[model samples]
Target: MTAGAGGRPGAAGRFASAVFGIAVLVFVLAPLLWLALRAFAGSWTYPHLLPSQWSLRWWSQVWDTPGLTSSIRLSLIITPIVTVLAMIVCLPAAYAIARYRFPGRQLVLMTIFATNAFPRFGLFITMASLFYSLNLMDRMAGVVIVQLIGTIVFMTWIPAAAFAAIPPSLEEAARDAGAGALRTFFTVTLPLAAPSILVAVILSFLAAFDEAQGTFLVGSPDIVTMPVQMYSLIGNYPDQVAAVFSIMLSIPSVLLLSLVRRRVLGGTIAQGFTIR
Candidate 1:
């Protein structure tokens, strides 16, 4: 209740806040710390709080392992492609859902939500059967299709909300200035919605990037993504190697989010998720 100098929180308030922040920081960082220690530790026997020896052997092993580099490359390639494809397919639908009042509208929205609402393994199993019939099994396209399923709700829901949030007056103003419908959309509407769309894009990219179960079921031996490779690392390699791979797998998401930290933290994401 007390204020310190310049009306800031008093000492006791600051201390409590600091303690809570530190606790949260530790809670979040502890797993990464454990993973880092395992990746570099040469011998960390039980009962020891720290490793007896630290080395880069596991890191080296991660780089030297067969198919690891390709998996990383595949992930880099696939996630971006999936993001773009999701935007291509879902963005228009998002715009339609946001702007138009058509038949079965709520059903469409609920259907999108339903994909993520239930358990996914059963869906993947059903999809695997379809892929087999369609000859999509073990193919890049099939993997992309599988990953796309993970991104649909994000790409659709967020951007649709973003588009819906925009004022019609802005687009009308652009149209009054002699801009055609498409031009008004590109100039006025798109820019206003861009922030939330970016949020959706990043979320979709991360969803596809981290997708593993469906990918493994569909692609198998031929298409090994980074997340799929994680299963192999955990099963076939030492825990240390798996830890190293885990860190590597995390790097892209960390860097991507870090680059857009401010934007993502801005109210755009909140606006996108808030249903009117």
Candidate 2:
């Protein structure tokens, strides 16, 4: 009787979990599947759930589109640049937050978290005017610098938390043995914190890559990106644009996230905040 009750509850829990998973999948997959079908069908009607006919006319045109290649190149260039800069800048910033005791630390962290709370688009005109004065307008370098300002907090904070989770005494031990700060960082801190950094880099790349408002806010027609191109394509050719660019825009991130997601989920960030 005891064994049967345990088995019954386990079976019920499994059924409920399965139902919830299927519901979530349907919600996400249904629209994407519809988009995939319609993109191949070369149709523009959206009120209908699915298109009746299917064709490859729109898919072929994706290659011939004039500005498509440029936008792709620009995005490919900018995403990695911002990710690299964010990672490099974040190392010291993370170290400070993790290891140091300073005035205004909580206030600074609060301010950084607050930036992600609000929509960054509200600052478009102000950011544009600021970048304009700095001569970043229409330049790839400018976009990178501008993106750097916004992404720094996310890039650093989580990694800092990861670094902090390591007992500080480890570093002290390394130092007592005569390792310098930089050497300790590379040999001890970095190896331990590497997976966190990888997660941060992937997150930063996706954040900058998908930024419609920031990209459009400071971006020009001269420097096109994938989302910018997709936006323009929506205005002109809504049919095929979703198909080709979906793969282009999605693959890098999907591959990266798949690799790093295990680390991210298993990370110290998963345990929530603890400042020491």
Best by TM-score: 1
User: Per-residue lDDT tens digits of candidate 1, residues 238-263?
Assistant: 88999989988888799779866887
Model 1, position 108: C-alpha lDDT score? 90
Residue 84 of model 2, lDDT score = 87
- Tens digit per residue, CA lDDT, model 2, 154-204: 677878887887888888999999999999888998899787777777778
Prediction RMSDs, each to the true structure? 3.1, 3.8
In candidate 2, stretches whose alpha carbon ends up further than 4 angstroms from where it belongs are 1-16, 42-54, 267-276
lDDT against the true structure, per candidate, is 0.88, 0.75
Q: What is the TM-score of each candidate against the true structure?
A: 0.88, 0.85
For model 1, the stretches where C-alpha displacement exceeds 4 angstroms are 1-22, 266-275
